[model samples]
Target: MATTLDAPGRGTRRARAPHPAPAVQAPTKKYRLAAAGFLSPALVLIAAFVVLPMVLTLWISLHRWSMFTPITDMEFVGLDNYRAVVASSTHMAAVRNTVVYVGLSAAVTIPLALLLALLLYFPQLRGRGVVRVLLFATYVVPTVAIVIIWSNVYAPGYGPLDNLLALVGVDSPGWLSNPDAALYSLVIFNVWQMLGYYVVLLVAGLTQIPEEVYEAARIDGAGPVRQTVSITVPLLRGALVFVLLMAVINSIQVFDPVYLLTQGGPVDATNVLSFDIQRTAFQNGLAGEASAMAFSLLVLLAAVAGILGAVRRRA
Candidate 1:
C-alpha cells in the first residue's frame, strides 16, 4: 500500500461549532410601560369626548330631560319622544323636504361635478389650474360669507340675477320668500358651493386611471363619449360612492342656509332634520325630543351608509 503524505488529522472530520440559537430576549417591562404611556392620552380623550357623550345621550333619550329642570326631576318617558316625532305631520313634512333636497342636490351636483372634472381633466384645456382654484375658492369660503353674497344675488328685482333675468324680459321669483321656489333655490346654492369639492374628488379619481387604458380604448375605435361612458364612469365608482354618501348626509343636515336665509321659511319649505333638531332642542325646549331626533338622524345616516356599503361590495 502506498502511504500518501497527509497533514496531521486530515483523515478525521473537523469538529464544527454549533450555530447559536437566535437570541430569545423578551420585551422588557419598561418597553411595555412606555407603550402604555403613549396610548393613554388618546384612550382618555376617546373615553371622555366620544364614548361618554354617546352613553349620556342614550341615557337622556330614555328620559324626558329638560334643560330647565333638575336631573332628579327627570321622568323616564321611554320612546314617547320618538313616537311623537313620527306622529307629527310637521316632522313628516320636514322629512319629505329633506329627502327631496338630498335627492335633487345629489342628482344635480354629481353630474355637474362629473362634467367639470371631465372638462378640466382634458390635456388641451388652458388655465386649468386657475380655473380649478377659482372653482374651489367657494368651498374654502365661510358659509356666512357665502350666504351674504348669495343673499344679494337672490334679492328681488335689483340684484344681479334679477337684473340679468330682467334683461331677458323674465321676471324673478322671490328665491328666499316664495314657497314654490325657496327650497330649490337653496338647493342651487348648495350645489354651487359643493360643486368644486366633488369636482376635485372626481379629478383625483380620473388621475388614478392609467393613461394606457384610454389609449387601448382609442385603438379599439372608441370615441371620447364612448370612452367616458364605458370606461370613466365604471372606474370612478369608488369616488362616486364617497361623493354620493357625503352629499346625502350634508344635504340631510342642512341648517345654516335654512336658519340664516329662510328659518324653515314660508310654509316650511326648507325645514330639514338638522334644523328640526335645533328648534326642538333650543327653540322649542324639548331636550329629550331633540336627543331622540339626533339619534334618529344617526340611525338614518347609518342605514344610508350600510346600503351604500352593500352596493359597493356587490359592485
Candidate 2:
C-alpha cells in the first residue's frame, strides 16, 4: 500500500539511481590533430617541391611545350613527344652510349675496387693507413678541380702524360678529341674519381669479417688465394653487389665529365642520357621531349633498382 503511492516520483528516483560514469574514451581526434600538426611542414614541402613538380613534368610531357611558346600556346600533343624522342636516331645513340658507359665502368670499377680493397685491408700490407688516406683524398677534391687537373694531364699538345709517351716512342692519341678515345678517357677519369670511395667502402666491409674465421681457414691449409675466393669473396658478396649497383647507376647518369670535358664528343660518341636530356631541354628548346626522356630514364632506373632489390632478396 505505501509503495503504490506517488508512482511517478518513485519511478524517477529509481531511474536516477547512480550508474557508472561513461568510460573515458581515448581522445583519438586530438591525437590525430596533434600528429597532423607535427607532420604538416614536411608533407607540405614534399608536395610542393617534389610531388607537384613531378606531376607538372608528367603533364608537360604530354604537350608540345617549348621555350618559344607561352603556357596557353602549348599544344596538347599527348605522347607525341615521347614517340619523337624514342624514335630519334640521336636519342637512340645516346641511349646506346649510356649503356656502353655503364657496362664499361662496372667492368673496370668493380674488380679494381675489390683489388684495391684487398691490397689495403690485407694484414701483410705495409703503410695501410697512408695508402687509405691518399686514396680517399681524391673523393673530397672538388669535381670542377678534378676535371681541370685531368684536362691538363690529358692535354694533347703539351700535357705531361703525352710528353712522357712521346719520349717513350709512343704517339699519344688525342684523349679528349678523338671520338673513340674520348669515351674511354671519361671512363678513366670516372674510375680514378670513384676508386677511393669504393676502396674505403670495401675495406669497411672487409673489417666486419671475424679474424677467427680467417684463422680457422689458415689452420685448414688454405692459402691466401683460396681464403679470398672461398671466404673473403663469399663474405663480401653483399658489399660487392652494393658497389656494382651504385657504379651502374652513376655511370648511366654521367654528365659532368661529358659536359666539361667532351661536350658529348667530337661526334656524339660520348653523349649519355643525362647530357642528352640537358641538351634537348635547354639548347634545343624541346621541353616536352626532354620531360619524356627524363620520365623514360626514371622508368629505366626504377627497373634496374627493382632487379637489384629482387636479387638481394634472393641472396
Candidate 3:
C-alpha cells in the first residue's frame, strides 16, 4: 500500500507485509503415467466387458438379427423390436413378475435382516459367530449349488419338507409346479439365500453406533424396540439404503434358480425379466427383441437408481 497520513498533521503510514514466492511443482507427467498404468487394466476390462456389450446391445436393439446368422445379415428395423416388447403379453408378464418379485423381496428381506442384525449385535450372544458363518455360507456357496439344494428342499411327496408337512397334516403345493405358488417359492428361496448377506451388512452398520448412545438410551428408559425405532433406524439409514438398492437389483436380475429349477415355470409364472431375455435371445433366436428387452431393463435400473438418489437426498 502507498504511504498514507493518519491525519494530515500526523503523517503516519501502514506497513505492507512482503509476499512469499510460489512453490515449485515437481514434474507430474511420470506420476500421471504411473497412475494411468495402475488404472489401465480395470479401465480396459470395463470397456471390453461392460461398455462394448452395452453398445452392441443398443445397436442390435435398433435392428433385426438372429444369433445363428452373420452380423452382416442384420436388417435395420428401427424401434419395431421395442414396439414388440411393449405389445407382447409374455414380455408384459415378465415385467410384472420382476416388479412384484423385487417388491416382495425388499419387504421380506429388509426388516428380517434388521432383526437378525440386532440379535447378532449382542456382545454376549453365544454362538453368534457360528450362526453368522452358517447364514453367510448360504450366500458364499455357488448360486448353482444353493439352487440344487433348494430344489430338493422344495421337492414334493418324499422330500423332507413335504414329509414334515404331511406329519403336521399340511399339504405340499408342488412348489415349482404350481403356477400360483411358483413365483412365491422362488421369492422364498431368494430370501433364504440372501438374508445372511444383508444381516452381515446391517451388523456392520450397528457396530458403528457407539455403545454409549445405547447406554444413554437405556438409562433414559428406552426399551429395545424403542431404541431400534428412534436410534438404530435413524443412524443406520445409510446401510439400509445400500441394502435396499442391492436387494432390488438382485431381485430384478435374479435368474439362476428360475433357470435351474422352474425353467420359467409350470406356467409363465416364474418367468422373470432376465430369464425371459436369455430365452428370447438364444432359445427363441430373436436377438433383436432380446436386445430391446435388455435395453428396457437398463432404462428401468437407471430410473430406479435416480429416484432412490433423489429420495436419499431429500431424507
Candidate 4:
C-alpha cells in the first residue's frame, strides 16, 4: 500500500512539472475601442459637413430647383442644367477669363516668389528678419482691407499710381475699368498678395537642406548660379511642387479680388469660374446650373492636382 501511494504521488508531480503557464495576449479590443473613441469627433464632423453637403449638391445638380421655390416644386431635370451651362455664351466667357487669370497669376507669381526667396536666403543679406516680417505682413492683413487699399492706389482720377504715370508723361489707362487691362490688374494684385507666403515656404525648405551640400559645391568651385540650378533647385523640388499646386488651385478659384475690384464688369473681362457660379446661384437663381458649373470646376482642379502629384512623385 505505501509503494502504491508513492507511485501515485510521483505521477502527479510529473504531470504538473511538464505543464507550463499559458501566454498572455495584449488587449487588442480595448486598444481599438480607445482609438475609435479618439477619432469619433473628427469623423462625425467630416461626415456632417463635407460628405453630406457633397452628396446634397450632387443630388441638387440633377434637379431644377431654386431657393425661392418650395421643396415640393422641385422637378427632376436630368442633365439639362449641365447642357445649358456648357453651351451658354456667358459661361464660355467665364471659362476663358478663368484660364487666362490662372495662367497669368502662375506665370507672374511663381518667378517673383522664387526670386524673392533666393534673395532672402542669401547669408550676406542684412536684417533678414525685418525683411521677412515686412513681406509676410501682407498675408496677415484682412482681404477686404487689402482690396480697399489697392483700389484707392489704382483709382484713375486721384490714385498715386496714375499720378506718377502722368508725371512720367504717359497716359494712365483705367486699370480696373478697361476690359483689356482689368484681368491683368487682377493678376498683378494676386501675385503681390501671394508672393510673401510662397517666399516664406521656400525659405523654410531652403533652411532644411544640409549645409554640407552647399559647402561641397563651393569647394568644387561651383558658382552661385550653378549651385542654384544644380543643387538648390533639385533639392527644392518638393517645395516647388507644393507651391505650384497651391498656386493653381488659388488661381482657379479666384473670386474675392475680382468681385471687389471689378465685379466681373467691363464686358465680363474679369469674370472667373467662381464668380460665374456665384452669379448663377444667387443673382440668376439657377441653382441646378450653378451646381453643374461648380462641379466642372472641381473636376478640372482635381485633374490638374493629379497630374502635378504624379510629376512630383516621379521627380
Q: Which candidate number would show the highest lDDT if scored against the true structure?
A: 3
- Tens digits of per-residue lDDT, candidate 1, 1-315, equal 334454576864445567879999998999999999999999999999988987777777778877777778778999998898899888888899999999999999999999999999966777998989989998999899999999999999789988999999888888888998999999999999989988998899999999999999999999999999999999888888888888888888888888888899888888888898888888887788888888888888989999987776765
Q: Once superposed on the true structure, which residue ranges of model 3 sit more than 4 Å away at CA?
A: 1-38, 310-315
lDDT of 1 at 96: 90
For candidate 4, list the clashing residue pairs, or say none: none
Candidate lDDT (C-alpha), each: 0.88, 0.89, 0.91, 0.87
The true-versus-predicted C-alpha distance at residue 315 of model 4, in Å, is: 2.9
The stretch of ten residues in a row with the least summed lDDT in candidate 1 is: 1-10
Candidates 2 and 3 compared by TM-score, better number = 3
Rank ordering of all candidates by TM-score, starting from the highest: 4, 3, 1, 2
RMSD of each: 4.9, 10.0, 4.7, 7.0
Candidate 2 residue-wise lDDT, 189-242, digit = tens: 999998898899899999999999999999999999999999999998888888
lDDT of 3: 0.91
The whole-model C-alpha lDDT of candidate 4 against the native structure comes to 0.87
Model 4 has a clash total of: 0
Candidate 4 residue-wise lDDT, 130-153, digit = tens: 999888888778889999999998
Residues forming the 10-long window of minimal summed lDDT in candidate 2: 1-10
TM-score of 3: 0.88
